[model samples]
Target chain A: MFAAAALALLVALILLVVRALKGPTVFDRLVAANSIGTEAILLLAVVGFLTGRPEFLDIGITYALLNLIGTLAVLKYFRFGDLSQSGGEEPEN
Target chain B: MEAVINMVLLTLLVVVTLGVVRLRNLFAVVILGSIYSFLMASVFIVLDAVDVAMTEASVGAGISTVLMLTVLSMTRVEEAKPAHSPLLPLFVASATAAILIYGTWDLPGFGLAQTPVNTHVGAAYLERSIADTGVPNVVTSVLASYRGFDTLGETAVVFTAGIGVLLLLRRGRSRARLKKRQEERT
Candidate 1:
């Protein structure tokens, strides 16, 4: 039963990949990538349970951190010409 | 009993995924994706993995959607429905799925007693982790104490990425401050 649930998530991951590949714009790509990252988090947990290794929770947490930072970096790049400039330092009002 | 729980979770996951694919509005897609994550988190909770569920709810549903929206603000929402046929993806995805299912043929059937993981350090850790680590969550114990070094490496990787992005995105610093000020005002 959990096996079936994991399969469903794997399918969702595939859809995220599709949305990412076929995105009409960078924003679409961003959303798709976010979904992919999310699905990966769940997959890590589910797979860990299948293997009965709690260590995989660590992997899930790490992936969560990576996913958040990566999304921010990408967003920063899109908003500013480069990553450092947009969310880096503050401008004087 | 467990079958019922897993089935419900799987159904929710699939439905929300389709929502992610079929939604015309970008905002709606983001919300749906979060729902998808929430469902996945619930599955983890049912498996008795509380730590993973907490992180998924926080990072997947909370931070992810917020960051996506920030990125969205920097660009235009795609108004048109993407219409690519899923021929290649369907083939590839189904093939991968089939392989996964086949691999599970050798796996223990839904929490049997004789699984190897239940006999190794895995079991020892689960049984004794509370006594060894001050933290009640075994997941945290394993990550912080038993595998602390590896976790550090992962943290460094995250820090490096953050610094890299910070380096690349700072466009003269002056305008960035301006944007923040504008946001605050708005």
Candidate 2:
């Protein structure tokens, strides 16, 4: 049962990869990338269960944190050319 | 089942690599690269290297993506067209890959317990790690206790690298404001 679920996740991952590759806009790619991160976390959990090592979920949690930070950083960079810049500050010259 | 997952993840990695190579838009390439890293981490998990998967997921998929995007924002979003023909590089890459594959032909079959690696310190560690470190997880014990100093050195190296990146990338608010005022006055 776990293996079947893993296979389904892989199928979803392939589709996500396609969208990331072929997306017309950068935002499209960003959405795809975010969904891919979610898929990866799920894949880690499912694979861990399949391997009978549920302890691997710790890594999944870490991945989740990193994914959230990474996405936010990217979005911030898109909004402000510099990551250090707060949006309330005057715009870049 | 494990092998099947590994193969599929590897295929996804290859497809993502092709996308990275084909795309001229730097932003899209960065996104594809993150996907590639996630696929690689999944592959590592399927191979039962959970520790490696974690590092790859955090560093490869997470930190590297932000770093590369920072670099992208600092430079052109679109890649410049190559000035030279790709033939030479292609030939070199193909030859290197062929040689590496040929070299691997001599490797022992996968998961053979009698392999030298399996019979070496790995076996000893497997046998003695728990007793030596009182840790249930062999990888954790090996990284944290058995090879504690080495891990410490690695941590120091990562720390120093982080410091270097921050020093390079950080722009002081005061400095920026000063520069802006100077520009305004001129």
Candidate 3:
């Protein structure tokens, strides 16, 4: 069952990769990259279950956190040109 | 089943690599690179290298994607076209790849117990790591205790990289602040 899930995840990953590679806009690629991160976290958890080692889920959690931070950081940097800058008062594009 | 998974993943990785190479948009390249790292992490998990998979997931998928995007924002999104023919680089890369493939011919089959890697200090580490460190995860024990210096060095390298990025990016802000203070004094 876990193997089946992993296989499905891999298929989804491949589709994401294709979208990332064929992007006509930066936003498309960014969305694809974020989805890829989400799929990777799922893959990690499913594989851990298959291996009977739940410790791998800890790594999955870490990846999930990092993925969120990374995506936000990239988007922030793109908008503000610096990560330290706050977006609160800035006019939206 | 494991072999099937490895094969499919490896094929997909190759496809992604080719896409990255063919793409000229920096944003797309960064996205593809992140996908590649995620695939690699999954491969490491399938190979039972959980520690390696974790590191790859953190550094490769997370940090590298952010770093590449940062660089992309700082520079032109479209890659500059080369004036020269690509033949030379293509030849060089192919030669290097061929040599690497040839070198791997001597490697023992995957997970073979009698392989040199599995037979040497690996045995001792597996046998003693739990008893010495009281850690169930042998990889953690080996990294934290047996290879303490190496891990420390890696941490130092990461720290230095963070500091370098901060310094490089923060200089403009500092300069702007100094100019503002100078204008106020004038």
Model 2 regions more than 4 Å off: A87-90, B172-174, B184-186
lDDT of each: 0.67, 0.85, 0.81
Q: TM-score of chain A, model 2?
A: 0.90
Best by TM-score: 2
As for candidate 3, its clashing pairs are none
For residues A1-93, write the lDDT of model 1, one tens digit per residue. Answer: 657767787668656656654567667767776776677667666766765755657656766775676667556544653433434444332
Better of 1 and 2 by TM-score: 2
Instruction: Give candidate 3's chain B TM-score.
Output: 0.84
Q: Write the per-residue lDDT of candidate 1 for residues B1-186, one digit (tens) a residue.
A: 445556756775776677577756665566555656656776776677766777787677666766565565566666475488778899999999999999989888777767787776888898889888877767788999989999999989978976774554454455766877899999
Model 1 spans > 4 angstroms off: A1-93, B1-6, B79-84, B166-186
TM-score of 2: 0.93
The residue-by-residue lDDT of candidate 3 on B91-138, one tens digit each, is: 999999999999999988978999888988999999988889998999
Error of 3 at B137 (Å): 1.1
TM-score of each: 0.56, 0.93, 0.88
**How does the DockQ of candidate 1 come out?**
0.08
Q: A14-36 in candidate 2: lDDT tens per residue? A: 88888898899888888888888
Q: Which residue window of length 10 is worst by lDDT in model 3 chain B?
A: B168-177
Q: By TM-score, rank the candidates, best first.
A: 2, 3, 1
